[model samples]
Target: MQQIILQPQTPDELRLVKQFAKVMKIKATTIKETPKARKKREILDGIERGLAEIKLHQEGKITLKTAQQVLDEL
Candidate 1:
């Protein structure tokens, strides 16, 4: 499986592609980026979230039968 990105030249073209995707039943979605001004803060926030999850698992707040279950999901 592969992903593609499109930076439409104009709003009209963007709308056309969006509408076409919807009509064709394709699972298309928008990705809003972290503004440059807060990019560092956003990266740190994501790191904290991951660390928190790891801590929970380490503290026995969660259990895993196998990591394969998570890898297979991807």
Candidate 2:
């Protein structure tokens, strides 16, 4: 079975979608994440990864690019 994800812009639209899903015998699950919440999640994830990389670099397990290298790449 194929699954679909919907982002309803309004509460009424969300209700309508859920109702349609119910009438179609489809399972409707609500997963809430506002734009701000998603952005915060992404930032936290990036910070976690950066910390992990720093730990690895300190342990001599990985080499990170220098500022010049990063700038050159950009």
Error of 1 at 73 (Å): 1.5
CA displacement after TM-score superposition, residue 34 of candidate 2 (Å): 0.8
Candidate No. with top TM-score: 2
User: Judged by lDDT against the true structure, how good is candidate 1?
Assistant: 0.82
Candidate 2 regions exceeding 4 Å error are 1-31
TM for every model, in the order presented, reads: 0.41, 0.58
Go through the candidates in order and give each one's C-alpha lDDT: 0.82, 0.95
Worst 10 residues of 2 by lDDT: 1-10
The residue-by-residue lDDT of candidate 1 on 1-74, one tens digit each, is 78887767688998998998899998788765568836986789899998898899999998755689888888
Alpha-carbon deviation at 59 in model 1, angstroms:
0.6
- Which sections of candidate 1 miss by over 4 Å? 1-34, 64-67
